[model samples]
Target: MAQQALPVLQPHPSCTACDLATWPGLESPGLPTRVWDGGHTEPQPKKALLLVGSHPGVEENVKGSAFVGVTGQFPNRLYIKGGNLADFADVYLTNAVRCSPRTSELVTPKAVAACREWLDQDVRVLAQCYDEVVILATGENAISSVLQRKESLRTFHQGQVADVGGVECSVFATYLAAILLPSNDPSKILAIREHLLLVWRYLKFGYLPTTVKVPPPSELVGSRVLDPSPTTKLISLDVETYGAFERNHRGRLLPRQTVFHPAKSLHWDGVQRCDLVQTCALSWRSPRGGKLRTKVYRLDRRAECDRLVSVLQRLRQCCVLGQNVPFDVLYLRAFNHRFRRVLARPHCVLYELQVLNFLQNDQRAERSLKNLSLVLGVADYRDEAVDLKKGQRYRDSSDPRAWTYNAKDAQATLLDYEFLVEAISLWYGGDTDKWSSYSRQWYNEVLWLTVQMSENGVHYDVEQLGRVHDRHQVALDWLRDRAKRLWDWPMSGKGSGKARERIIADMIQQYQPEDLGLARQYSRRVKKSRLTGKVSAGKENVWLLMGVVPSRTPDRGKLLAYRRFQRLRKVVESYTGPLLHQVSEEKKTPNQQTALVKGVAHPSWHSVPSYASDEERSFGGTSQCRITPRNPGLQTEPPKIEACRRSRFPSGALVLADESQSEIRVATGLFGDEVFIQRETAVLG
Candidate 1:
């Protein structure tokens, strides 16, 4: 089945700018407006469709009509003045809440009340004239003003029909035109116009129009949500510490006496640039990938971290990811807690940046979490470069270095977190596996907001928390001492590295009651009648545990191996590759759904290990291609198994399959283990 394209909801040209009348900060000759084509407006009956919205521009007040600004004027002249819909049912347009809402424009309670009455008047006027009416709330404000469901954007997008003060109504809510279109997309415009045209027709006839309602902008004033299900978010952060700790001959992170690297004040008269005095950069790339676009934010001010507190508060909505995102997050969290600041936003959804491996044994040495970015592979890391530049600028800028660098690093870290999420979407056909799990990680999205790119936190023991190294160290130390004492007969350096092995051999030879080289009565190799064991001579460099020795004696080969249970130095024999968390879902079976905390899977690592013998043989070795018996684990397949084994032997290896190159190839994900097969394989570690 063909997949449908995702709708790219964007601003319409008629509403490219914010309610222009509201933005006092902008210096505009007139509000941006667009006129619609009257030819496009379809004819209707006596039914009047009242379009309700929030922004009423200054031009609209002057012209006494909706959509009359530079942007609105075009649409008005095209659709209204030219007159097509006006021929049938009169089109009455008005704003639900008057005056423009802007970045700094706070709509007072009294102002809203006044606008409410004015909106009701417009609705009442239409109710008196039409036998049937359809009210369309063009934006969130208009829908919310009537529905009192401001946070209903999700549900409102689905369309709704409800009674508003006994006036039969179907409200269709959409984005404000002035806010949506600048980048032209003809198809989208046509679709929206058609939707409106059909909606008007439905109103004119007796047919009930489909409608949806969304939360109004005012209702969202305090509708922040926490606990993103599926998983929490992670926000990664890093800080660049520069200045020396100030103390009275005592080491302490002092506040008062410590001077920020770059002194405050960054006003360059006309141009806001300043000089730098040694600054550090905190860089990070993300989860599965990183941000390709570098964004440098100069932190020249000493109060940079303080300023960042607000930005981060907003960013904590989604999980943030990064290498050691915790370090920055922890630091930021501490700052907020200490300052008693209500971040307004929740704690950063946190995830440690990592590429986890899911295939093979779980004991392989973990790769260094740091310095493992795609940069080595020539991949661009926008977050790293930009943050580095920003740190330099911040150091160069005349601002408090600590504060600026801390927050700037936080931003960089978060960006990387975000980039990883984006990167996963690109590398894979869709966000699947580890990347998908990331969306569920704690504060991961929140962390994503902080950096350009981010990664998952595959548990790394870099600092070796929880005694993994200590246990191995103790075992190795005992063995080292044992080897030293075993060779006490001679301190010569002949077999320096293998002193213990030489000593053991010499001692066994000298103490032989029966000739040590004599062939045993019933065996060729050393045979142990008492235990199921093999002779050490069978394997090269095999360590033999003789009998128990004194615990204090330097003979760990005897004492540690035979008397005590010791954690070996090589316990971690193998490891899988770094991978992102795919999906944490339960695998379903014919019987029942699997348990939670398990649906995760990792990709297969084609980097397989090869043996020297396999490499030398080159042709048709099992290491390169396997040929299993046609019926595995069965008595009937004995001949097939033997044939398969002999074919892979060094003397019988073949270079080509069949008489010539096989043109038609077929591969099913399923592997019929019972059938003999061969395929090329890569040999790596």
Candidate 2:
């Protein structure tokens, strides 16, 4: 079969700018007059979208065509790859400057200005050739020629939608495809593809397509669908497990030992015994619904467990909607590999409520299913007759009440899903298309990314961390002994337990300028107490001891040591201690590992305040490489922490790259801060 010919733009004979010889740069030069590239000349069924480039490159100049050379192929490839755009619409490729300059530098503002008339004429002609013509101005020169704006390309790189030559189009000031392609980063490619996808969708749909199409429940199962198709089927699932497990406020899993149990009046010994799935309750509403069908599968029998796994595998194909789907998915994966693979895309009713709450800007979005059910007026499972927390293992318990609790939970989950679906549908004015798009595209993608991030955890160095912990402990002990000696306190016995606090109290009580031989330089004064509203003798704290003491004072070293001790003590207790406990001893390798879990706001990397470690504050590395396992402040840690940097890449090698001052540059351009731009330009230059 022969290839169909592409449409080309018909040249305007009467237009003076169409003739390259008339332009200033090519007036006394030698260059081709008709530099227009290959495109459809005749009107097409669909609209034509034009991608405008700068002046022709060296290869383009030889070929006498725009976007056919090395530089032009970048956008051409993207255009074809972006949703098969060519099949839907006619695409015209052209340049701002028709005649190529003899020298690279000769393609200047004067030449661009001279060629602007021809570009404008070409756009005017193209606008008439298509029903809806859109122009994508590629670079600075192309944008300037099309938009006729004096501002540089930096101002428009963020992308703008406007009317060009009476045709509505999107201007991409940053689409330097050739430059971006060389990096070979998939993320960069994906970014460009996403932008192009948006552009193509805008051209096809008039308005940008914001919604994602939700696959129908029947379509999801396809040929595997159960007999007798129904408009709606409620599939509710719940799993009961032996042994207690819970997540902390920061979403890190803490052992029962770290958790305070008021009933037991004690904390569990930080050891978490391996837990087993006790029972799984599956409740479903059939097509011919009279009453909900419920079944409780006990893991005691091998046949029953296998049956449960098989059923779950099928349910996964459909939207296995549940409360805290990630938590359920994690346990399911741990139970069976098949369950793990199938439950990867399970929908969470909790996540749906969160999305709706976020959209409404509801600050206090209810997270717990129990709380949410109450607010949403859905059936609350917690009010059931059975004590849900009483049973340890379903095999041991013959009580029918335990099974009823499980069944009730499954039923409640299904009811919650139905209620949320209706609520969200009503919120969107019954436009399922818009609601589906927001849910699948934005909410689903975010949830999926979070799950993947949690699975791809970070590495930890147990040996190195242990060494650092010991050193900190030794230093703290020495600091305490020194403080005790300074205060002339007893070195041994029960009094030593509270020695440090006692020393601090004594120092405060005996605080005098003469004690530090600073009587001549400093004097104490009586001050009104803010809390008691009474005039009292001035008090001295660690800050005053360090800052107010004379430089020549002999006791300055002791005060500084005490301050250092306080800082190190905090680092040991609050940060390192928790982290050390979390490191798994079963791994048997010197380099241990820790994992990150997704939080409501961000991916929890277990970051800690870097200021706690003195070495971290002064180390100065180019990239941020901090890791605070079992602690919630790692992300805030500075890059200077050497231990953190080492821990980031446990294999003893580090590779880090970041966009330097990208936000500052964006702010400079957006606000048109010429002074800041000039200053940055000079400094960067």
lDDT, candidates in the order shown = 0.34, 0.48
Best-performing candidate as measured by lDDT: 2
Error of 2 at 278 (Å): 2.1
Quote the lDDT for 498 in model 2: 52
Please provide, for model 2 over 1-685, each residue's C-alpha lDDT reduced to its tens digit, 9 standing for 90 to 100: 2223343344323334433445454432222223223344344534666677666666665655556676577776665444455555666666666666544334445556667666555556655555565666665566667777643322332234556555555554334455444443223343345446645665667554221122232322212433222333345667655433243223344333222111111112332222334456665567574445556765545566676666655453344445554445454555556565556654322243334433332221234555444434454333344433453222232235555666656666666666666756775667665447555455555555545544443344556556776877788778768767775543233564255445444454455555554643333432223223223223345565555555666556656776676577556654455455433122222211212111111123211122210100121212232322232344443342224433233345755544457668778989999998998889778
Residue-level error in angstroms, candidate 1, position 159: 57
**Tens digits of per-residue lDDT for model 1 on 1-685?**
2222211212122332223434454232222222123422343345665656555455655554456666455335433343244454545555554554432123333334445544555455456655554665654556666665552222342124546556756655443444334653222233234335535455445443321111222221121411112222344444432221222112222232121111111111111122121122223333235422111222334344343444454444544444454333433333335212422224544555432211111111111221212211112122322233222322222234333334344444444345555655664657366445544553344443432211110122222321443454466556556545664432223553244345444433443346444524212322221111212221121222242122355544343442232224222111111111112112112111111011111111111122111100111112322211110111122221213222223355534233112221223114543232333222111
Superposition error at 354 for model 1 (Å): 1.8
Model 1, C-alpha of 534: deviation from truth (Å) = 21
Q: Candidate 2 — what's its lDDT?
A: 0.48
> Candidate 2 — worst ten consecutive residues by lDDT sum?
608-617
Off by over 4 Å in 2: 1-236, 244-275, 283-295, 315-317, 345-361, 381-399, 421-436, 488-559, 582-633, 636-685
